[model samples]
Target: MSDDAPVKADLDEIRGLLSVMPKADEAARDAARAREGQLTKPPGALGRLETLAEWVATWQGRTPPRIERPRVAVFAGNHGVAYKGVSAYPIAVTAQMVANFQAGGAAVNQLCAANDAELRVYEMALDHPTADFTDGPAMTEEECATAMAYGMMAVEEGIDILCLGEMGIGNSTSAAALAHALFGGKAQDWTGPGTGVTGSTMELKIQVVDEAVTRHLPEMTDSFDALRRLGGHELAAIAGAILAARVGRVPVILDGYACTAAASILYRADPHALDHCIVGHLSAEPSHRRLCEAIGKQPLLDFGMRLGEGSGAAVALGIVKSAVACHSGMATFAEAGVSDKD
Candidate 1:
C-alpha cells in the first residue's frame, strides 16, 4: 500500500466498526412483504417503493425503519476558478444563493420543507466572486482542517439521514480538477459547463481545469492532497461530513455533481464510505453521469435538473422515505394467504 493508504491499525479499527453494522433481518423482511401483499392493493403495485422500504430497513438495521425527520445540510463556498469565466453566473452567486437557502426561498429550501426535512447551510471560508483564471484554488490545508472540524460536528446534530449540497460558483471546474487529479482522467473528460455557460465558455472552463490538474499532478498523492489542491471549501466540508455520517451510521444523500465530486474524495479516503451513501439523483451535468457510473451507483431521477443546493437529493429523499415505509409495512405471502411463486 502507498503511504496514503490507511494504516493497518486504523484499517482494523474501521473494519471493526463496520462489522457492527446491524444485519438485515430476513425474517422481518419476509413478514413485511407478506403484510404488503395483504394490503388492499395488488402485489408489487407500489413498484420501487417496495424495494426502497426493504433497503431502508437493511440500512437502519431495524424491521420498521423510520427516518425520524431527516435533515439537509448545504455547504457553500467559492471556487478560485470561477474567475476564469467558466460559468455563466458570477461567483458572487454562490454566497447570494447561500442567503437564498437561509431565507428558505431557494429551490432546495422549498423541496426540503415540502418533504418535511430541515435544512442547514454552512458557509465555508473561500475566495469569493473570482475575477479570472489567474487565481488558483482557494482550499488551503488550514481551511480544509477547519471544514473537517465543522462538518464532523454538523453530522453529530441528531439526524437519521444527511443530504449534502454545495453552492460554489466555478465549483464544476473544481470538481473536474479534483476528478482529473484523483481519478487519473483528462480534464476535458470531467469538465462541463456549470450554470449555463456557453460553448466557448465551456472550452475555457476545460482549459482552466486542465491547468489546475497539471499544476497539482505531482502533489496529488491521495484524496486529501487532491482535495487540498483542487477542492472548494464546500467540497472539503461535504467530504468530511460524509465521513462523519458513515462513522455515525447514518445514510448520506448526495445532491449534485459538486457534492458527488466530494463524495468521490471521501470514497478515495475510505473505500467503505460508499457503504453509507445513497446516491440521490443523476445530475443534469454530463460529467455527473460519468462520475456516477464510475462509482457504480445509479441516480433516482433523470429530470434534467442541475440546480444545486441539494434540491435533487431532497426530492430523492421522498423515495427513500417511501422505501423505508414499504419495507417495514408490507405483508408476505403467508399473511395474505397467497401461494409463493418464487
Candidate 2:
C-alpha cells in the first residue's frame, strides 16, 4: 500500500466499539432509588419522574445524575434521492436550515435555550448527498463509516447528556427506507407523509422506500449494511454518536422519526446497544411509534412533533434537568423531620 493511499474507514471499527459498550451502573441506580425513597413524597406518586432520576443515574453511572452540560447535535445532509420529487420542499432547504440553526433562528435554537443545553449543528457534506438507494447503495462502506466517525467526534468530554437530531430534506424517506430494510416490514409500514407530502407524493415516498430496499436487501447481510445502503450522512452520523455516547457514559435522548431510525441500526446490531438512550418524543410520523416499539424505548414526550432537527430531544432535556433538580435538591424525610411512609 502506498503511503499516499486514501485512509479508509471501516464499519468493523464501529462494531468493535459496540462489543466494548458499557452497561448502566446498577449500583448508581440503586443508590438513586434509595435516595428516592428518602424523599418526602408518597411512594410512586411522582411517577415517571422517580424513574427518570434513576434512569439518569443508571446511564450516567453516578448518583444524583447531573444535567449541567447537556448538548444537542443536529446533523444536516443532502440526499441524492431528493431529486426524485419525494418531498414538498427542495433539497436546498437542507443547507438553508443549517444556516438558520447557525444563526439561532430555528425552533431548535429556542428549545435548546429553554433547556439550557448547548446546540451544535454538524453539516455532513451538504454538497455531496448520498447516492439514491433506489438506484444503488446510498453510500459506499467507507463513506458511511466516515460519516459515523464524524458523529462520534461530536461527543466531547464532560457532556452530561447527548440529544441526537437531523436536518436533511427528504430524509424522512431515508428513515423509512432504513427502518423497512432493518425491521422487515412492508414499505408502507415505515413510510409516512414527510414534509407534508400527501396523495401522490406520499405514494412515491413509499415506492422509493420499497424499491430501494428491494434493490439492496440481498447484499445487506446485516444492520450496518441496511444503514449504508438506505441511510443519509446525517443518519449514519446519529448512529455514530449513539455508539460514542455509550462508550463515553453519556445518556442520550434521540429525537423524532429520523433520529430514532438512525439509532435503531445500532439496536439491531445488538439489542442492548440502545441501553443508554431514550426516545425524545412521539413524532407525528406514523412509522415512529412502530419504530419505537421495535427498539423498546418509549417516547419521553408526545407533542406530536415531526420537525426533526433535534428540537424534541432538546425539549426533553429540560425534563431531565427537572428530574435532576428534584432528585438532588429536595430535602429527604429525615432532613425535613417528616414521617416516613408506613
Candidate 3:
C-alpha cells in the first residue's frame, strides 16, 4: 500500500520495515475523544464501545471513521507436521474446508454474510505443505517470504478493515510452537486440545512442539527467523496481511489463537508492530488467554471460541460497526438540545 507498493516483500524487506512502521494517528484519536465528550450520552456509559470508536478513528486516520468495506481473509494451508498425527483431523480437510468456504458453507462465510463483510479464502499452496519442523525449518526464507508477499496481496484496495483468520491441520500445534519459541515457555504451557485431541494425542502434540522449538531455539536469531523455522504458509500470510493493513491505514481484527500467534511474530519483532490491531475474541485453546495476556491485548469478546476460519473476527466486526454507527451517527448534546453536564 502506502507501505511503498506492498505487493512485494522478501523476508529481509519485512524485517527492514519493522523499524519504520507508522503509528496510529494521534490527531484522529484526539478528535474521536473530543466528539465522544460532546455526544448526548452520559460520560463513560458506552465503556469499551467509546474506546473502540477512537481506535477505529486512530487507525483509520479520520475522526468520522467508518467500516464500509470490511473484509475477512481466511488463509488455508496444509501442515507437513500433520503427517505425524498432531491434530485429530486429517490434512485433507484443510482443502475441503477451503472449498466449503468458496461454496459459502463454512461458519466464516455465514458470519461474513451476516456482518455485511466480504470474505476471501486463500489456499496457500495446499498441494505442497512445508517440510516438518522436526526435520528442519518449516519453510526456506524464500518460500516464507513469498507466502508473506502473497498475504500482502490479499488486502484489496478501499477495504476499511481487515479480519484475519486461518485453516490448516496441525496449525494450532504450529501456533503453540511459535508461542513457545517466541515467548520462552514449556511446550505444554502453550499447547492445547486443538481440533479436540485427547490424552495421548495431546501429549504427542506437546512433545512435537517441544522438539521443534528446541531444535530451532539456537537458530532463531530473530522473530523472522523463528517464523521461518516454525510458522506455516498460512501463518506467514496472516503476518503479511496484518503488516499490509497497518500500512494501508486499515484497522484489523484477529480471530482466535492461530491468527493472533501469527501476528505475534510482528509484535515480537517490533513492540509497536500491532498498534492497529485488536483481538476479536478470547480463544478457548488455553494458550490463547496466556498469549493475549503476554501481548497485553484485551479481546473484545469471550464466547469461548476456538473455531478459527475467521468466524470470531467476523462477529466482532458487528461491534465495530455499532461503535462506528453510535460515534458518527449520534447527535451531539448541542444538536439534541440537551443540557450539558455541570
Best by lDDT: 3
Clashes of 2: 0
Better of 1 and 2 by lDDT: 2
Stretches of candidate 2 exceeding 4 Å from the true structure = 1-8
lDDT of 3 by residue, 1-342 (tens): 111223445789877777667787999999999999999999999999999999999999998899899999999878899999999999999989988999989998889989999998888888888899999999999888878888888888899999999999999999999999999979999999999999999999999999999999997889888889999999999998998888888999999999999999998988789889999999999999999988879999999888999999999999999999999999999999999989
Error of 1 at 89 (Å): 1.7
Candidate 2 residue-wise lDDT, 87-151, digit = tens: 99999999899889999999999999888889999888887888988889998988889888888
TM-score of 3: 0.97
Worst 10 residues of 1 by lDDT: 1-10
Q: What is the C-alpha RMSD of each candidate to the true structure, in Å?
A: 5.9, 2.8, 3.0
| Model 1 local distance difference test score | 0.72
Would you list the C-alpha lDDT of every candidate in the order shown?
A: 0.72, 0.90, 0.91
